[model samples]
Target: MLEVEQKFLLADKTALLDQLAQLGATQETDQEQEDLYFTHPVRNFAETDEAFRIRRIGSENRVTYKGPKRNTVSKIRKEIELAFESGQSAFEQLTEMLELLGFHPLRSVRKRRTPFTCQHQQRAFEITIDEVEGLGLFAEIELLAEESELQEADNAIIELAAYLGMTHPIRTSYLGMLIEKETQSGSD
Candidate 1:
């Protein structure tokens, strides 16, 4: 499926939460997520604009494959995700298998995310408040759509972000931002 998502840096988390409440958004899941990213040994995923991430949230584990962004304005991409109930053990096994098969582990990202959802004019949208470790607060509004419905989803995301008082738009991923910050500071 196509994952149509937009992210912005949140200056005030409380203010956004208040806005979401005013908009009648209901809290969905509040969880901490740890993601481990890997690179193919023979291919450069960064150059190819692809990502392979293994994520653990609470007692569940998932592996996600994200294709390149389809547009310049929004983070619309092709994504496939699989969930398993085996938790951390499965995650470790997967990591070991990937390493053994030549996939290189990159880095791990940790974040506490609380997701909220509301319906506008019968269409549903998800708003996630993310407190990423070392990355600060971010708000993301996302919807899944077909390739043909991307414009509609993008328009909706823009409207929702504006309503929530997001003045600065951030299209970069947390991983990219963190890497850039570290690189600029000359720290690993």
Candidate 2:
């Protein structure tokens, strides 16, 4: 399925949360998650966009391949699983498979998600409620679907920002930004 998701960087969590309460946004679940994304084992994948990931959050272990949709994606995956271990082992081996497919690994990011309880919302824009860890109650509005909907999604985000009295609208991907911070701190 085509996915459209965007992250809104909020400054005042408490204030916006209070506004959310006033707006009738109900609390749902309070689950935390720690995510770790890895690259496919294919050496050439270092330059491609395909990603083979191993997500370890709470007690769940899921291995996912976020690569371009290929005709034999499922068939190839079944062959790989039957030939190797599951979870991390399978993820590691995916890199090798990508190599055989003439694809290369590209970017890898690890983000810890702590998503708060978010019931369904009735807003003016299209939103995909992200139940992640570390970040609570994320509003992801993907603009990748109808390229034209980009402006509409942006406007909706702006409205949400105003309604919730939010600030610090971050543009960088959280996973990449967090990793960069950690690296900078370590080097310093």
Count clashes in each candidate, considering only residues at least 3 apart in sequence or on different chains.
0, 17
TM-score of each: 0.95, 0.52
Model 1 bad stretches (over 4 Å): none
Tell me how far the alpha carbon of residue 133 in candidate 1 is from the true structure, in angstroms, after superposition. Answer: 0.4
> lDDT values of the candidates?
0.86, 0.44
What digit string (tens of lDDT, one per residue) describes model 1 on residues 81-152? Answer: 999666778889999999999998898999999999888756689889999999898999899998788888
Cα lDDT of candidate 1 equals 0.86
lDDT of 2 by residue, 1-188 (tens): 22233466544456655655675555544434334445444333324434454454444455555443223211011101122344555555655665576654444443434333333233333333343333344444332334454445445555565555543444444455655676788999
Model 2 alpha-carbon drift over 4 Å, by segment = 1-10, 42-52, 61-148
Ten consecutive residues with minimal summed lDDT in candidate 2?
72-81
Query: Backbone clash tally for model 2?
Result: 17
Which residue pairs clash within candidate 1?
Answer: none
Residue 106 lDDT (model 2): 41
Q: What is the Cα-based lDDT of residue 85 in candidate 1?
A: 60
